[model samples]
Target: MPAPHLLLVEDEPRMAAFLLAGLEEEGYRVRWVDRGLPALEAVGREPFDAVLLDVRLPDLDGVEVCRRLRLHHPALPILMLTALDAVEDRVRGLRSGADDYLPKPFAFEELLARVEALLRRARTAPALSELTDEPLRLDLTARTCTVGGRPLDLTPREFDLLAYFLARPGQVLSRDEIHRDVWGHDFDRGTNLIDVYVGYVRRKLQEAGCPDRLQTVRGLGYRYVPVSASLHDDTA
Candidate 1:
């Protein structure tokens, strides 16, 4: 595919120029707009993988812009940028259809990270249906996870890991495989990150009073044993 296109909507010219230059250096194709109305017009004219929208504009409110985009362009990832840092303001932005939030005076690195994560999340939204075990559904679109009729509170990474495992249920996935599959291939392997995250998953399951569905494959890897199979085998 072509380099991801970003619609950058910030009223300040210098800030918009900085973002455009930085993101272009990172190989993203950016189209910068200085107002909400033109941003909406540009978005309506074509497709973009993600949008960085300023929450305040000279003639239009950013929340309403987000709402309009969401009504018609629901799948497009929208990251809201604002000087407002109040919890209520953040909540309002999210409730108004922003997929991610970034406050002013933010690090450029953090903004890039949020943009990448939002795009990643958007990419996975459509393929989520085929990435889970039956009856234990994970709707990435709805941002809900359910296991055997019980809902689970999972952090984003945990949810991704679980969904990945369920998609390949009964298969022994190595630490490297797990990391490459869920965390991305660029993830550093030197750290014991997979082990730590697995431990987190186990603790969450145990705390939820599960029947111990996750199993260590005797120093090799991990597997998600089905609840029924656990009962009959007794040794898993």
Candidate 2:
């Protein structure tokens, strides 16, 4: 397959250079845009497998950019980068239609993993056709998801996280395993990255009326089982 094309929109020159170098090293073809307007124009002109958007921009805010992009192309996956880590900031990011949110000062390794996982999950079939205990339905080709006949407006990270569970339904996966598979092998397991993103997914699922599907296994890890399935099926 051709290398995945990534649209990186960051106002900070240093940050943009840093991310471009890292993504290029990972073999991704990247197109850099310094402001929101150019980013919007670029997205409208070409096809990108995924987008890395910064929240604070000179011309437009990241949330508005995400909203505009989603309006033009609903299926395009967007991951927002910002220094804002507060609950309300995160909420705003998702509400604006960003698929995932990454606070500033993130690890390059984690960034690569996130991009890869999003692309990986983007390659699955639609979730509606399958009614199994697995609550995920990925049509990677078309980049769409439908959980229990209801569509999930998943950011790239949520989609990748859901796809990871579907790939190993009913199996217990440690946080380390999830990070290795979803984030990348070089990611630091010490950070609360997994937990934070999982929380994001839960909130979105709840919005979709399928919050119960993604279960917290406490000390073990997390798993996804269809909410419509038997309550006794705790294996997921």
Which residue ranges in model 1 land beyond 4 Å of their true spot? Answer: 127-236
Model 2 lDDT tens row, 1-236: 88999999999999999999988888999999999989989987889989999999988778778866764455678899999899999998997678788898899888887887777776773323222343545665445677676677888767767666764566777898777556643468779999998898878767766545667788999876654454665554
Clashing pairs in 1: none
- lDDT digits (tens) for residues 43-127 of candidate 1: 8888799999999988667887886676445578999999999999999899777999999989999999999999899887863
Alpha-carbon lDDT of model 1: 0.80
What TM-score would you give candidate 2 relative to the actual structure? 0.54
Off by over 4 Å in 2: 125-236
Q: What Cα-based lDDT does every candidate model obtain?
A: 0.80, 0.77
Model 2 clashing residue pairs (backbone) = 99-155, 113-183, 122-140, 123-140, 124-138, 124-139, 124-140, 125-138, 125-139, 127-137
Backbone clashes in candidate 1 total 0
Quote the lDDT for 95 in model 2. 71
* Cα error, candidate 2, residue 110 (Å): 0.9
